[model samples]
Target: MSYHFGRGWSKLTPYLLLLPGLFFYFLISLGPSIATGFFSFTDATGIKGAPIRWIGLDNYREFLFMGRASLDNLDALKRTLIFSFVVTTVQFTLGLIVALIVNQKLKFTNIFRTIYFMPVILGVVIQGLMWSLFLYPLGGPVAKFLALFGMRSEFLGGQPTEAFAWVIFVQIWANL
Candidate 1:
């Protein structure tokens, strides 16, 4: 009887030890996800003592089928898709080219690899700050270089198209 009891206890020990972590995971992660899904079908303003009413799929319908909001949402979706496609394609091509070059028996291969790998290891915040400093419209290195060639324009703070291009460039630079 003692041997069977010890075997059963040993079998249950790992699960017993995991109980607290499982409890917290349910409480913190799963609980909120379920609550968010539930709340999505209702009108809850997050105001204390506010009456919550079930609106069903009205909100989703408005977002997807209704007025000016739908147009804006579709435009945003289009831009997001374009951005994802451009970034993925450019990053893959550039990475492949760099990999091929690095694999060759060339002088300064280690140095070239290090230069290409530097942006990947750097934090996003550091990269953003460095780019901002380099591209700052007023008296930045890029602006100064452009001035030397008698061509001056804001790289980041310029017109919408220019700003968008600069953002894409920075994202590719940091990610690659």
Candidate 2:
């Protein structure tokens, strides 16, 4: 037997081929997205079958105006914004510089171009894990070298400012 599509059926082939993708998209992506949007307006405890009361704007109020709210969430937001902006700026600047250097027709610049794109081939999780290992203060080689001075505090466990600083530095190092 052979599979064939008549001229009429050919017009529907793309949709037929896309059905599986559409099914999975609705099941995995759209379903959760709509649920999240709906849940935002309700007080739904994570417990299965629990009652979910409509509490429109109440949750948003606490996050926006509660006294202690700013200390926790707002501080985190500020730090994240700063870190992301700095890292993006560095990436853009470095990309431009590398592109300029590689465009100069230098012999070894092709090697640098290959090296620069190597990170792009790795998944974000893998790149993050590799950088984490590089900066791990306990048993990492970098930390071992610092251990000679009797220092043992991990990069991320130090003071808040310093820890955030290292986070920015490590992100830039990994991405650049």
Candidate 3:
């Protein structure tokens, strides 16, 4: 070993081997995060060759003050919060009940556990896309089922109220 490497070389070798990964992580993670933070202070339209403008706090002010000037905006925000609260409450309640049920000594507990935990195995984006396909317009299961009951309408595309309900439903269903 001593003949193959210079004196003290092995002591530094592990760190040397680690540099590439460290550099790669810095490039992909930290660099992008810092750059994004910086860009948040600037107006970056993301268009090729578009001039970037430095506008500090303007974007934040827009969102934070969006409702104060307009009653419509404030109502929209209230509605959004209500939807969020309902979905979170439903998810928590169902998850707790299912956890308790599965923890009990009963037949088919394994199957029930698997069903409850299956969504947790799926990545968030994959779960969203899977549910979207099953709920989307025209060829979607929801639309076809509705058609059978004399209800004909596009779910994800046409109906905003129904679409929002489905969003909350899927969110709770996937999370629970």
- RMSD score of candidate 2 (Å): 6.0
lDDT of all predictions, in order shown? 0.86, 0.81, 0.82
What would the TM-scores of all predictions be? 0.67, 0.65, 0.54
Best model number under TM-score: 1
Candidate 3, residue 166: how far the Cα is off, in Å:
1.7
Better of 1 and 3 by TM-score: 1
Candidate 1 to truth, TM: 0.67
Summarize candidate 2's per-residue lDDT along 1-176 as a digit string, tens digits: 54466567786898899999999999999999999999998999899999999999888777767889757887888888998899999978987897788789788887888877877798888877886786677797778877899877565436788778777776776678
For residues 49-100, could you state the per-residue lDDT of candidate 1 as single tens digits? 9999999998888887899989999887887898899999998999889889
Clashing pairs in 3: none
Please identify model 1 stretches exceeding 4 Å from their true place.
1-31, 48-51, 65-69, 144-150, 154-156
lDDT of 2: 0.81
lDDT of 3 at 138: 78
Evaluate residue 102 in candidate 3 and report its C-alpha lDDT on the 0 to 100 scale: 88
lDDT of 1: 0.86
**Worst lDDT window (10 residues) for model 2?**
1-10
Q: How many pairs of residues in model 3 come into backbone collision?
A: 0
lDDT of 2 at 133: 81
* Residue 124 lDDT, candidate 3, scale 0-100: 89
| Backbone collisions counted per model | 0, 0, 0
Model 3 — TM-score against the truth? 0.54
